[model samples]
Target: MQFHHHGYVSSDPRVEPAAGVGVNRPDELPDEIDVLIVGTGPAGIVTAAQLSQFPNVTTRIVERRPGRLAIGQADGIQARSVETFQAFGFAERIIAEAYRITEMAFWKPDPNDSSKIVRAARTADDPTGISEFPHLIVNQARVLDYFAEFMANSPTRMRPDYGYVFRGLEIGDGEYPVTVTLEHTAGPNEGATRTVRAKYVVGADGAHSRVRDSIGCTPYGDKANHAWGVMDVLANTDFPDIRTKCAIQSGSGGSILLIPREGGYLFRMYVDLGVVPENDNGSIRKTSIDDIIKQANEILHPYTLDVKNVAWHSVYEVGHRVTDRFDDVPTDEIGSRTPRVFITGDACHTHSAKAGQGMNVSMQDGFNIGWKLGHVLEGRAPESLLATYSAERQVIAQNLIDFDREWSTMMAKRPEEFDSPSELEDFYVKTAEFPAGFMTQYQPSMIIGAANHQNLATGFPVGKRFKSAPAVRVCDANPVQLGHHHRADGRWRVYVFAPDANAAVNNAAIDASTLDDFASWLTTSPESPVVRHTPEGADVDSIIDVKVIYQHDHTRVDLGTVPAIFLPKVGPFALTDHEKVYATDPEVDIFAERGIDRRGAVVVVRPDQYVADVLPLSATAELSAFFAQNLLPQNASARV
Candidate 1:
């Protein structure tokens, strides 16, 4: 029989096997909960699911909504967010539900005649030639539901409950145990509120976060005066294939964003409230859409604007601001002690919808905080680690604001007149100056955290680093069936780099080697997995690229300090300048003599495929110690 785990059980088990979580009465409250996650959006649910992965943790998510958020809240799944979904074993579901749009169309009105002209076209054509999972268009609810499923199936036996509202919170106690007051939305006992004591509380509630308000935390940033009316229309229209477009329709204040969804177009109409300021805060009303669309038609002359069926509609006021810090500070601050009650997504920062970053940014906010919370809950790290969340995510929030600001500026600039690269350079300079380098890793959340044994300065918690690695099909030429690497368990890996030894040594454990013994080790080592380069052997590229390391470049490094083990032909490598000895010298005469890519170095790869440490082949003891300290130990000494 198949044994499936954590999920909500509704009355109809077949249809809602794990959909609704029964409410926990006030009397039934546990003595202590590992975490109290506020909000049910992308960030809250993802954090709860991640926290529930640890066996000892009991996480409870309190969402005020009576049911799942139904609407076109956030639509696009950025490449990085998709990878994080892969880690949670939900990427497939997202991909299945999403509509794949590879191309984007941006049209601007001809200022002279009011006729539309193609401004720029964007495509996911593998420009970087590295990403495996490109962007996708999935509704925000589906992603949240995946997170809900993940939490329900977690080893911690905790699932998110909808229709539960948080009434109040108290965080002054030394142990950080929070008393969360919650009540169900429906039923006889619906309005009743009960107090729940939790070890930690995460305020993932949106922009106007109740948790933030209760915690006395006020948002800091420049609020936008204009509010945009974004409507998601479900209709078969003329521009079915228009994935994204910055159309400057006639009579416009700000440009409109036309995002073609599955049988729909997510339109963002820039409602001009007059020249208040950039990213100033305001509100949007439904009546404003008709005017906005009218302007859109007038500005964008070529495409006939037709209002079909409106599936979902909402207005959001954009802002450009970030919380000063994420942790505790002087008592004078508004929410100083409430730093433990962290916020993400719209709660922390807000930006214009131009860069198509609303959903992408929200998922990333969750990605940034989830793993760090997990680490802290496991007791594997100190409370100081949690401080990094605000530090890291705040910068990302700032960058998003900056990116949106610049994008708007670029859109405002006349494309035809710009001759010099000055505009691009200015944009790059602004981006480069942004504090959070974490934005790049946000979408693909796959880079592994550096191990303490590797580098102390860069030893971010494992979750942050792990979120950056790519999940791809590690292809092989052989026709035999094989299992792909799974991220479900969240386990890290250590790849031993030595000249191919006998297949016996290819076992899970990495064995260090000496440079001088390299040639002899490959030919004579009973456990060596490395095979000598012969005309009869398998293709060298396939062996190393596909089978051994899987799809990703799982940490290539010089095996050791042994000078003899250094790569035969290398001045430098990407991650480090360390040398790498070839497994078997290639057959190519020039390469055999001049050396080849660093193929022999062994690396300790974190579960997220981040390089933890590079062990020189010469020192087995040192390598063993490094692994023993960082990875889950087979023996009691390393076990935490």
Candidate 2:
């Protein structure tokens, strides 16, 4: 499928028409800036958008090319990336523009011959548990356009100084800042050079990053020599069954995936440039439009080959490497300390385009680091919080790289030529049945939902398997009261397990008579171990609110009941049928099963919704200390 517009606004009128590098750049560049982003790709744009959110921060993005966003580099938007968009208040816009793909169709050739054309499987029919925006099908350029608009609303705006070629950087501990030189590509100011000065810099530059090189950071991993050609087009021809993500590996030549992007199909074909002789020169320069269409059709199956219009297309090699270091540091330091200057997106890691992790990973990287940087720069968070960026994100990136390697290997493996004795074909067939995580791992690892529990006997069991926070069910029939940032307020909310319990009994239990009695008992009884406070004017519906729970518990518990009132704010509140037990501790296993440690009465979660510090029940002082260390003065530790 392809799309062709008879006439459109051409940003580059005097198009030099060079593929990667080796194009003449613009002469003039920005003179001053606080933060300079190196690339104008998704990563670069998203980073600029995020950085622009800070009122004090000055950001400018540099695009080497003089055009709009790429047509179809990547399409899949993982669950986590959706959550991230919500944080920035643009998830809805993205979802509206993109197609919601509930199912992925996987097929092979031949019914009887299970070796090569094994079987077809799909996930569309399965139930997706509790999510509004399940999946989407927007292109990379449109996503960037959304971000560009969002950034425009912010104090710091994105200035599109296109065709600016990066010369080099002047890095030092002293003043003068980092100097970035760029030259104009066209017009009277064409050969003019301009220098930009910024306090901090970001290298959102692509895999072969000039900014990365200037910073002395080295990318780690084996280089993939193979190149793939992708023909992104818009066509009227219909593949009724092709909904969102589709894989056609059983075709005449090899694998051809027709992902249903917005308005048209992003037809990606895995071409072996090494084997194909004509691909050597990298010059489709003189090839007519018809010839290009023919080439694309030949690459895709002949049966499905019918192209009327070609909107945009590009062929490029893949970068299959994860950089060991994102920013340069003194070799003399000898420790993996944080770099004041950080690089993210493709600059940090690059993998095969098969899983479409490129843009997604880049966006996640920005989301992960952008907020942290904002807080630290704004003095809302401790400086030490910045260190957590690499520690958390590196693991995520490594896991994704591992998944891509497996996916790439599976696609490269020609099971048709192999023997049937090993049951290897069965493995691939089962892989088709498994979740998308089995192939991409990035989605499952990064996405909050569908995660398992981590098994740890000691300390704050920090691993990938953290239970997702329950979000406000907006679509549900029940009129549950909801609030802004219901998902990411960094509060351990507790709900009294009174699900549909008798309203009369519930009222009787908390009304004037019983409330006063309970409060008196809590204060006088030596056995009472809970704090006491009033839940006056609180939202008392069955739906849980941390503030409400804390108020109710504090109102009921008496002063002398338990010598020291265990502050509900900094300890695990028991929720069990076993009832209150002052003589014995609550069952640790019960809390552990719920993925919270009972021993650490207090578990502090980061604002991004990940566990940060866990405090033991025995040491209430440590809870105070945890707050002192984890939060800034703005947090108002007294409130916690």
Candidate 3:
């Protein structure tokens, strides 16, 4: 939201002034580029959007389809994806158009009449309140549209090159190591083939990814024996919970997972099609729409459905699969060889859609690799940094495969199989965090530091997404979520929590001597990451932004008393940035809520908003060492 520094902006600030590669961008594909992303799905678009933030990094995304996706199969938007949308600056707009899932209704066979199903329990969608953002049900296509829009508005003005199908790719020893072969699917150059070289290539092409095959990576896991018929329809149903999210289990008929869609009259139903016989040869996929509706009515028992229109429908079998690694680097050659080709989303992992994790997890896959690729391509980090993408995300993909397999199995179970009637509901309540996308916790790596000083800020767990808390902006005295301030702009964050204020005097401010000393060390010390990593002549806060949060109330804090590091001069006019200073809201103390030590603490957050490390204010050396492992010094020559 900061603007007008370069010049007075009479137009919308979201539409960044085009520069670099974005200025008069060519319509035809470039012969050489810094990065080439394949596919325009959820994962592909997110990767492009994140890469678009780095104007100097030339990034291009291609799609086989002629244009944007009309209707996406995935519709469930987890809270974690919504939080990511907040960082991308479109959460509010998307939420307004999305259906908020408040509660989930479970139905079981009634004792009085075993044939009929009755409401068993109604549980809150997020009973544990893992995130302030709502669990949404928005079409996957719409979500991609938002990301595509963000890319277009960015300084790079990126847009997907439609009708360009990825043929294959090969890694070489040259500067632009990845030579990608592509075929034009449409336009005057239709049926023509071309080759483009890239420094790094990302494959988001999907389950049958050509890029994955070229890299010698294969997805290995169990194929589903259970089949389900899914349909998005506008219907009139006598079922009481038709408009609500319901998990219905009938005495005779199969179970049904009814999820309300965005529009008031439209909803999606996953009608159980029973177990597929061995050697059936995918015959279950032929289940007709009429058959799906009939099965849905049978599951409802006394109630019936009169379908008016079928929006979209499909038949899919539940399966769990994951690749060994997400990059071209072989297991044994990881450290010695840097990866030039990468894969994400369905290319790396595949799972059931019933858990609503296919698109959500895929988006995270894009985010994980996108930043790493940007850092290396921009010369901000060493080539060794690219190796961590596979090391970190491969484990997360495996974890997701396991969680979805269990959830899908539970959904396919019959009513009699459960030991207790509440087993299904109990499982849903117990494993809420995993489905909501909050269970991911990356292990210690070069990028993620060890939790040696976890006690300093217990609420901000290392390697997990930074949980947002309310605090007051000192300049404007406006309440804001600390985590929401983070944007997907490819800059690391250093949150310096000041010590508690003295209670002896009314409205007494925190002691500034400690903050001053720390600030001096950060700006002047040669070992400081900010001083070592930042390129010559660049803004002080360009690579790593430092902000301060005082323990005193906003009214008691004096802006002039704060250190200059928290208010660095930047932009063409060199205007002082005041947004970095914040104070604990009187009503809601952020320090207490987030368990920050009353004495003092420093939390280092990754560009993706995960808590990388927590240290005391005095641990400047430890902080320097942590970043030294990840970032390359500005003067050092990049391997790429």
Each candidate's number of clashing pairs is: 44, 25, 0
Candidate 1 stretches greater than 4 Å from native? 1-31, 118-126, 174-176, 235-254, 263-287, 328-339, 412-490, 499-599, 602-640
Q: Each model's TM-score?
A: 0.68, 0.67, 0.97
lDDT of 3 by residue, 1-640 (tens): 7888788999988888887788888887899999999999888888999999998889999999999999999999999999999999999999999889999999999989989999989999998789999999988899999999999999899999999999988788788988999999998999999999999999999999999999999888997699999999998978888778999999885999999999788899999999999988989999899999999988998898999999999998888999988999889897988989999999989998899998999999888888888898888998998888888888999999998888888888888899898999999999999999998899999989899999989999999999998899999999998889899999999999987746322455545476778888887778888888888777788889899999888988888877778888887778888999999988889888989987678999998888899998889989999999899898521110
Candidate 2, residue 75: CA error in Å? 2.2
Model 2's TM-score against the true structure: 0.67
Give the worst 10-residue stretch by lDDT in candidate 3. Answer: 503-512
Clashing pairs in 3: none
Which window of ten consecutive residues has the lowest lDDT sum in model 2? 576-585
Q: Order of all candidates by TM-score, from best down to worst? A: 3, 1, 2
lDDT of 2 by residue, 1-640 (tens): 0011213325532221222111222233446655677777777776776665665555667777776666646776755566556655667778887777666665555545432433366545225332333556677788787777666545444455677767778775543357777676655777787777866677777777888788777778864544555656655444444444655454343555556666545443434332224345655333454555554444333234566566665655545677766555544542454455667887778887766677777876765566666655555456566555555566667877876777665554444543552333344344432222212122221212122222211222333212333222211212222122333212222221111112233244323332233333333332221211111221111111221111112223343332211222221222111111111112222233334322113333344434343333233343334444543542111211
lDDT of 1 by residue, 1-640 (tens): 0112223344433122222232332323454676788888877877776666655556677777767777647776666666667777667667776765454444544556544544543333234423346567667777777777666655555665667777788766756567778887865678887777877788778777777677655667775454566666544335433455334423343455566554334543343323344433332344465665565455454665687766666665556766655433323653344346777776767677655676666766665566666655654334554655665566667777777776655544444434642453344334431212224432212133233333221322233332222222112122211112324333434333334222223253333343346434433332322222111222211111112222112133334443321212211121222212122211222112222112343344443333445444444454444433332221111000
Give the alpha-carbon lDDT of every model. 0.49, 0.49, 0.89
Specify the highest-lDDT model's number.
3
The global Cα lDDT (0 to 1) of model 3 is 0.89
